[model samples]
Target chain A: MSEDEIEAAAGASVDPDARHAEKMRKKKAVRDKILATKTVEKGLIIVHTGKGKGKSTAAFGMVFRSLGYGLPVAVIQFVKGAWETGERFALERFGDLVSINAMGEGFTWETQDRQRDIAAARRAFETAKDLIRAGEHHLVLLDELNIVLRYDYLPLQEVLNFLTTEKPPHVHVVITGRNAPDGLIEIADLVTEMEMIKHPFRSGVKAQKGIEF
Target chain B: MSEDEIEAAAGASVDPDARHAEKMRKKKAVRDKILATKTVEKGLIIVHTGKGKGKSTAAFGMVFRSLGYGLPVAVIQFVKGAWETGERFALERFGDLVSINAMGEGFTWETQDRQRDIAAARRAFETAKDLIRAGEHHLVLLDELNIVLRYDYLPLQEVLNFLTTEKPPHVHVVITGRNAPDGLIEIADLVTEMEMIKHPFRSGVKAQKGIEF
Candidate 1:
């Protein structure tokens, strides 16, 4: 017996399998149409910001991916300082393909000096500018830059101008931190805001070495 | 002149710098107190979910971090299949430190057969169970397992039972996909929902080599 006839004899109103297949066929056609229209290829100004974690981790994931292709990448930690992180240690194995410069003194509360914080931010931004202008790296990550920008340690206008006008067309930039500025969000090609639904910290779980760092 | 006296003479009601310093000092004390209470250490059930990018990317980030420490890790791709992704390629360089199993035939739409999809999921879950029970790997990433569970391809209770009862301690499990089950989220230690604020696909920009894949 045919599948539809068997289903009808089995007291089913319709052949669910055939119906689902037909539905998926239409969906695939729509998806193909949309995907075919997307042909543009260029470096994206990607932003990862929110209260949750993985802002820098996701950026580092991209860095590792870039390194896999033997692509040059630069990482400028604007506010994390030069702590020995698991990612840092791992990326170091890549040798000359990756350059990670943790330029911040520490968190603002840890520093507690606005002038010193501003100076550090300025220095980091200078490094970022040099890297982006040189276009030597395929991917440049401004880690925790949104934190610096949120605190007004660096001039937002100057940073925006540099990113929009001075950055090379082929250099992909990933800016990550909480409280991304509206101006930065406006110009970003892609943005993902990670929302913290539940955290182990709330249950008195300390951050592990390899996991958190 | 004393700093406070100079500020007073300059018509400032209070020394802003001194007040700021005092405020930060108090904040630090509170933070330290909370941090001191957190001493628990164990494997974490981390969930990366929601309708945004980076669910799998962030999981892969943790995988890379784990590999950096020379930890054994296994990645079971439930829906992605054996595509030539940048992460897969990059992770391959880790050799025996990492094992990536792309067991899915494809998405449900691509397969267009519910029974086949269910069989594939069952097989993949069996592999996951074996890995978790063996406790051989320090980290196990069930990439897109949520997609399988969401479709009811595998029994959720069975999966939950295995995770809670059968899995060995000290094996950190990272589950990635959208619409993670409430039961899984309830048992998870850390859950971050990646919210899509904007996407380049809307602007006709296709996924790039290193950035997306």
Candidate 2:
């Protein structure tokens, strides 16, 4: 149809007041329904694991998305403390809404100290415990947390209890690592096991910038 | 001091325009200079795999996030297809931005048919090819896609070429399956290897509603 014809056709009927009132009524119904449903929702435990990659990064995506809502979030990096450029900048922007505690001593092999890893984990759990119990944080991301449990550096049952029992109903917990404990999975609301069928590292491709951290 | 006296002591006179403009200027500067330097971008491949669980559901989280942005996204399930409550209800809310070509044929084992699997993949790929080539789509999640390559239902090199050569620079692709091909990994900008350390199926946890799809 021509532009003039389409415009005239759309304007064939003129009921401004009636149409406006109808639209208002319909809009009010939708608005009310949304407002009624938008209450405090249940918290979730998102466990990301597998041979395939992108678990920690995916969890961070959730952290950013939740932060986008202006909600409080806490992130604890278990295996890493590289002092990444990303976290340094995010700290300034997100400020108090986001709390981060990295080990500062890179990976375990770099430090090569089992006791140090346990000490670091203990400190992170202390911070995380407060966040979970206080009910202030809407999201908590435990980055590469499974390594702690896998290595027996932290008590799995205790951590699982904290995740299951201590976590406030409104606070979401995201755990990213290679090996997730079965106890956590049993209690988790959502569990993802990423099986590595193929990886770029296998094909001799180093992690690219902006794609991998 | 009394509450009123404390308030008075803390209060300070300030120009509203100066205050607002200062904040705005600071924000703009950060957006242009500081934050611009920090690398925080998303367009990585999330390869959710394993003999474990929740691969497709995890990818759904990203699909949900993208839809929240009001951008177009396409999900192509490779082998298994059924009317899941997730897409039928939540995804439909986004209308044309989401689609599911559920073959209603469940999985390959149930049917014991290779030919049918290949046919379904072709159908899904037809939709995916355009989404990858077209830069308009913000995300394209190929659910169970890696399986097509593993099951040898589709040629891996052809799929890689399409995903690599034809992919729009800004568009992001997510491939989920038990095994992703080596070629796909080699070409992928971001490849995830999900290693399954523990699974609930071994511990006798039947797939429950709201926990496992």
Candidate 3:
């Protein structure tokens, strides 16, 4: 419709409010149409990767949301060592509903042992495979699994095969880390790259407890 | 140092493992020095903005993390209406420790009432100001307040002034949404832009319960 016709259809006046309302009415109609077309539902392969922070934090948020529904969740930390973190302590309050396994010795640089890192990654992957195969949990978070894959600690093809073929249809898998592989991204239903605009660390701010951890 | 000298310092032999360990040690020393210099401790202004998902999800993760620390948190959602969400249900389990106020009627497109939208924004901001002023909560999340500011429903200068000058020193404030104001970004200690690489919505997947909500 022409501008004048659209305005008249919204209202018989030149009021801006009426024009905006009419514009929104058209937009909502389009949105509702799109919403109607989206009908597929199943567990998703979600990937969070980039240099910026919050990759794992967002995944943890999903875990928390899932817990609200009394759903079981398994968190497998592949890079961070077994250490006390605020999220870990908080999630532990849910008891058996939450399972967190910090499998890595530490960062690769900290360990500086390729063989040892590979061993740790393999062990973590084994635990993850068991959890996914059992299909007891609603969500399984593979925290930092991409880092291990990037370093070639675990075979990428093998991991992808299991996820695509063996993962239960009802289980949602969230994989988080920097530098997620192309294959993983291609298979992931949703992928978000947290781009760092500004970080406090660059301003000499240390990672604060309850914030960074 | 020369390449040969650097290699000799790491290890006399040309073993990759030894060289890697030595390189890590040097890196550790530098990292330690930087950590030592970052002795400042104070609450931060965190901003998560971009077109991708997980902006509020990350903030809610922080809330969950804070709850783990037994910290009080207040969540003020400015754009989303008071609706049943998994995260809201999850947080309500924390009882008095969590206070959520879903003040917006809905998105501006849905409401199509600028005056009413402004009123809602004002009321929400008033509640936010009160929570921040009380200084009782460890973290206060202004979820989607950026959208209000972006639409000019609330005075950006007034909000920035309060955040900069009147906000309690001990309370961390997290503001999330797309198109965050430049002034807010200038004052924020940490800012992350969630860049969308792939979204399932484009692939005809509906927003699933316990995942999108």
* Residue range A124-183, candidate 3, lDDT tens digits: 999999999999999999999998999889999999999999999989999999999999
Better of 1 and 3 by TM-score: 3
Q: Which ten residues in a row have the lowest lDDT in candidate 3 chain A?
A: A80-89
Off by over 4 Å in 3: A1-13, A81-83, B1-13, B81-83
TM-score of chain B of each: 0.89, 0.73, 0.92
Top of the candidates by DockQ: 3
**How many steric clashes between backbone atoms does each model show?**
0, 19, 0
What class would a CAPRI assessor give candidate 3's docking? Answer: medium
Query: Quick one: best TM-score, which candidate?
Result: 3
Task: Put down candidate 2 lDDT per residue, B14-110, tens digits, no spaces.
Answer: 5544444445455556545643444534455556655545456556656655655455777776666422553445466568876555532455544
Task: Say which prediction, candidate 1 or candidate 2, comes out ahead on TM-score.
Answer: 1
Ranking by TM-score: 3, 1, 2
lDDT of each: 0.86, 0.63, 0.88
Q: What is the lDDT of residue B84 in candidate 3?
A: 50
| lDDT leader | 3
Better of 1 and 3 by DockQ: 3
In terms of lDDT, model 3 sits at 0.88
Q: After aligning candidate 2 to the native by TM-score, how far in Å is the CA of A32 from where it should be?
A: 46
Clashes in model 1: which pairs?
A: none
